[model samples]
Target: MSEEIKVQLTATPGEKPDSQKLGFGKYFTDHMFVMDYHKDKGWHDPRIVPYAPIVMDPAAMVFHYGQAVFEGMKAYLTDSGKVLLFRPDQNMQRLNCSNDRLGIPEIDGDFVIHAIKTLIEIDKSWIPTEKGTSLYIRPFIIATEPCLGVRSSYTYQLIVILSPVGAYYSGGLEPVKINVESDYTRAVRGGIGFAKAAGNYAASIKAQENAKKDGFSQVLWLDAIEKKYIEEVGSMNIFFKIGGKVITPAINGSILKGVTRSSVIALLQEWGVPVEERKLSIDEIFEASQQGLLEEVFGTGTAAVISPVGELHWKEHTMKINEGKIGELSQKLYDTITGLQSGNLPDTRNWTITF
Candidate 1:
């Protein structure tokens, strides 16, 4: 239960990758942050150690029962040579939400943020300064108790890793093609859909793989019950702009409340743009496209920040959004958010933390 974070610097640092070729989550820094939790001892021994594989028992609960949760965030090395994190506190808070759903013990979100800052300080050089590049931070918790019973593990591990990554999408802000998946459902209400649990992503890989095989960059998931209502994109929350009003699926119990999504909504509201959160249907979107009302479609997440959707293929019909080009609103949002992240724009909303 000691609050001090023990730091262990790597003796042989890994070679830095070329900034231009730094793809997302491909390269890891020299060190990582780790903490362990037990029902008796609680979370203790917070430390930063060399980046390496974690040794776990073959019968660990996370392997059999899948009691794992993770989060995605980024650290930007601004043009002013300042290290910045955009809404990291929100990510930590969501991590606890996931932990609650997965039956994992909740660590102090503030203390974890402090540990993250310390980890970043030790590996600040790993934060890329290139345009459209930043250090991607992944904080994950996994059940480590070596028991195979159908219950929550008594021991857990919380690990944070850093990777210097370029744009998540190879095309940067270029629009991407998406496939509407009706055959498979990502999650249902009263499930782990709202949490960033590992099982949710595991359940999605099949649908995403099928979409990729059909020449789509991602899959637009539908609700599990009826498979009619729009839920979200595979890795990002979705937004549709029809007749100049923005609409996104309301946060029911099944959608991941993305940090970037919230930020985008805030920005739109501050600019006096109309935004709505409600139950949206795929049929309604296709209808809007037919009527020339579906002006823009985009996805938001920590990885891409803003990804414009060019085309959506549902059943036999195809809906091309914004004429297969990034919408004005999408471009403006990308520019504004990236500007704020990189310190090019003023922090009017105080969304970023700098070191």
Candidate 2:
């Protein structure tokens, strides 16, 4: 990989969507980062080009074999007009992990970060200054070899696209209701569950759609084998506070190791709050609620940061957490993370990178 990247500006700039109406992943910036890969060339021709449709063969391997992975991150605009990225290095590292699992060639995380910063600088005006609004960056790689054979593709394309997005919650933080899914399994042990592969999400859409029909915001997935132990939500990793201790399911090759999940754990440890990462059962959570030990329940991810779980609907049970309200610790973690991201608070942990 070379440090020199070609830049191509757009001739006609696209109209920027209204910041207030910018929903999640709905709008794009004026430019994007792209780099091609071949078995002989490794990865080359890194360039920042105008945002447009990518021309790929109809018989592309990605359309047949589903060898694709993506990473999600955000760039925040500070009150002082500085642009900050929250733990982008972690996202790049995770992308490589996913690539290894999917048999795709690994990318240079550092160089990719540089490319992303360059792309963001070109489209910096699309970053929203509204509270809780930021520019979302999605970097993905797809198999481009036009072959029907069931094997790894030698040709690939890595593209980074930017989207201006509003906050997950337009108003204040509101706790959401999650439906416990038992029939549909999201992933199994020794599977591609931990990787951020595109197919993993496609498999979860049915359960998520069913849960939404039941009036739930998201589906809480259980382990694929027993379907009893809690795994994660469809879009976020889950956590629970019981008896003054915070517990989340351990990463055992079946759960996606979320960057925000690790950050939340670090924040809890910094505050001297007891936190554990191990196998947690939904029955145990219900029992904790029965014993009045359940204090708070929340989900953590790049999109929402922290989503307090106000209610959980299991079979023949409806557990209302924190009296169906946001807990104190959940609120504190959200404020601290957002404060660091928005440059409102001191960066004691050095979690943000500014350009």
Candidate 3:
């Protein structure tokens, strides 16, 4: 039997309703899960505590050097009134992978799973059941040792927080407009891009903000060295369909190995939708758009199962894909993935874990 971890809960007396309606990481739940790790004691003092501010040293490694890693996932409520997690073990595994890369201490996967389950049980009421709405779970680790050095800290804190989110797109699943960043780079060879580290995101926020300023939703990042081949979109893995073939950038050292990206490839292969994983160049995609062969482009991640890319703006040149509408394959992919996640379809892979 697993050890029973204790949590001290304090409820927020009166909180207003979540009215933002926009669903990309907004309103946070009342409570959060936290655990600490030290050199001698290892991981201890695990608890599900109230969501509040945490005090940290100004010179903490995470604050200065950005030695932090995080994972994104969701808890879904099915039509049968059961709360379930979709492929949580995969997320735990990825978390460990990220920890290894970020020089953070590793926690047992089963222990982390138990902690998450406990936290969800306590905050189950916060999960939204509306369509395209669920509880977004964020698990992250931060270096907390007080020091001014650049090396990894001997102390760390792991926390999991919940947020109730609505749909990712504001206009109801409309395709997104992307800006191709030719100058800024998201990741590079031998970099921490594959890991869900904080620095990777901090480095891209400026580029993303610039894209948003130019009337685009996100930045479609490219390779760091050459800035030619496509890497990924902001916070999501990208996919493109042309000539009836689905093509996604291969998992090089620079690109994140997204769970949704892998699942999409598997499902497409099962459905016999010719799929290819290779280095997809931006120039090739532009040419394909000119020839009217680019059928669709989309991003896959935990936040948005599949966010369609309707247009790309590169170097003052605009290329519209799928005529600024969601493609058939994009719809099918979304339906299939969501069906599996929501228990509406047969989960042949046993991806769902009921609570």
Give Cα-based local distance difference scores for all models.
Answer: 0.92, 0.95, 0.87
Model 2 TM-score (2 dp):
0.99
Better of 2 and 3 by lDDT: 2
The residue-by-residue lDDT of candidate 1 on 62-150, one tens digit each, is 98999999999889987777889898889989999999999999989889888889999999999988778899999999999998789
lDDT of 2 by residue, 18-69 (tens): 9899989999999999999999989999999999999999999999999999
**In model 1, where do residues sit more than 4 Å from their true spots?**
none
Off by over 4 Å in 2: none
lDDT of 3 by residue, 1-355 (tens): 1445777788563363474563567678778888888989888888888888999988788888888999998888888877788888888888898999989988787788778888888777777776788888999999999998779899999999988888676556789899999878988989898998999988999999988898999999999888899999988999999899999999998999999999999999999999999999999998999899999999999988999999988886899998899999999999998888888888898788887
Model 1 clashing-pair count? 0
Question: Which window of ten consecutive residues has the lowest lDDT sum in model 3?
Answer: 13-22
User: Judged by lDDT, which candidate is best?
Assistant: 2
Q: Pick the candidate with the highest TM-score.
A: 2
Q: Per-residue error at 307 for model 2, in Å? A: 0.5
* Best-to-worst lDDT order: 2, 1, 3
Where does candidate 1 clash, by residue pair? Answer: none
